[model samples]
Target: MAAPIFSLAFALLLRLTYATAQVDPALISRACEYAKGGPTCVAWLQDNEDDAELSGIDRSDPDSIAFFSLKKIEKEAVTVSEAVSAKLSAGTTEDLSPATQQGLAECKDHYVPAVDLIKEGVDSLAGKAYPDAMKFLRTSTLDLIACQKSLAKLRTDKKDTEADVHATDAINRRDLLASHVALAQSILEFAASGGGAAAASVAAPPS
Candidate 1:
């Protein structure tokens, strides 16, 4: 249970500033492929596979494809976070948004510590002893959502202030870093639950 969280933490630590960072088209397609399963996850995989085929076709510029792919990944993360948080809070679809700041507000106790800790890393979080990190991780989906808004607003602001896309890409880079941190906490919370344990246990040598 704790191992996954720890693993994610380590991954994010290595990622440093690129937490929610967007990947190339090929990576996005690959992630979607892994998510697809039978009726539940598989349908997604097939769709993503199809999407991958069209990846480069949609772009005259390479950055367009990267931006589009990044959007897809961020959107998917938002969708999953919303679904899980809604399940936890018994809320509705109105709760989730990439451009809004609702997810964290609605579920802050459950996710902020993880968010902060991931941002800060394991040596900083201090393991299971730190309940706040767990709470933060639970709400990481929300942070990702808020990050989207920050980046969007920053873009608009940048247009009024300067010529560099630096303000925009810099914001995105920050969000990506936060996303990675949240992902670490999410992986931990998921692994700690009975469901995670069972799943992990199954992939190991028989007792």
Candidate 2:
């Protein structure tokens, strides 16, 4: 009976260890540490371990991980853009201030370019052109920052609680994109040099 109990405990421990070994929590956390989502971003990556975009990916390869991260951010940008566009298109705008409405409109205008830049980065990654990928990511980062600034200006002009809520959500979305781009840049650097030079290059991603 004692031998059987010990065996059972060992089996459970092995299973736990196997599960923990499957995903690198530290990698996810470090990758998303700069984003607004923070821990939530890490959780998102963990939850999406089985995503088709990441299928059969070698998690140990920095390039592969960066590609996967870029694809994820691209999807997120698409989703957010679509949602905001639909809201502005079909939803009533009479309740919003002119500043808020204008800001949202500007965001909609930039969404296409933003997604395009990310897609370009994805293509660059696929082609093994890490520097090109980083450039595209940087361009998208700037676009997101511009969108956030637009919303920030809008927020200052209006004190409506509802607009404030919308602004907060929009800012968070921008931050997530920015974080993912930065992570992708870092991953590329790590892949290129393995250590020292990678750290210096990624310490300041283009703008």
Candidate 3:
């Protein structure tokens, strides 16, 4: 009887483990293939597998993966926006030029709106309003690009090392967000087309 109880306990543990296991590699590959930057999408998903909100999701479903990606993007946008705001608030003490200060303020302006758009996009995604979600996401991307370009212009005109550093960082982060936006768009497109095995099969394998 004790042996049977032990076996049952082990079986339950195995079941729990399986329930919480990472998404299947094949599934991740298949879903990521839809993104413009497949490898980046894969890396993001892999790195965020343990995210509190993502961990509870059914990662096997392409739609769920897309939703998770959108939420992640929203979170990133919010974080970047807050960082910019913090920088602006603390800039009073920094030896920043007036032009640099204005540029950073503009970046904050762009980022604040971008965060709002991303949040709206996430909400639309949750509601299965794919078109609205994509529209909002695309607009958010534009805002991020504008912020990046603002920094670039400042860096170019001022030739300030600090501005250059900020521009470089913004470029890298914007590019990552763009990739995630593309990923979410592709998955949303698949879902809009009646996502299933059939819709998934239409995508060509990643090179």
Whole-model Cα lDDT of every candidate shown, in order: 0.36, 0.61, 0.64
Mark the regions of model 1 whose C-alpha exceeds 4 Å error after superposition.
1-131, 140-144, 155-163, 190-196, 199-207
Per-residue lDDT for 1-207 in model 3, tens only? 445544653453355345663465666676666554568767776666456655544456665666667777877776666665555555554555678678878887898888888777666656666777778877787788777775654433444445355555655666667667777777666655555355542332232
**Which residue pairs in candidate 3 have backbone atoms (N, alpha carbon, C) closer than 3 angstroms, thus clashing?**
none
State which candidate has the highest lDDT: 3
| Candidate 2: tens digits of C-alpha lDDT, residues 50-149 | 5554443334445545655776788888866765554354324435656667777888778789899887776666665667777887788777877776
TM-score pick, better of 1 and 3: 3
Error of 3 at 62 (Å): 1.8
Task: Give the alpha carbon lDDT tens digit for every residue of 1-207 in model 1.
Answer: 567666854553345333333334343343333322124322322233334322322322222222233233434444434443433232222232333234333333433433343343232243433344345334545555554454444222123333123343344444554544433343333333321333331121122
TM-score rank order: 3, 2, 1
The local distance difference test score of model 2 is 0.61
Candidate 1 accuracy as TM-score: 0.30
Give the worst 10-residue stretch by lDDT in candidate 2. 195-204
Clashes of each: 22, 0, 0
lDDT ranking of the models:
3, 2, 1
> Residue 70 in model 1: shift from native, Å?
21
How many Å off is the CA of 161 in candidate 1? 9.2
Q: Which runs in model 2 stand beyond 4 Å of their true positions? A: 1-45, 49-58, 86-94, 155-165, 194-207
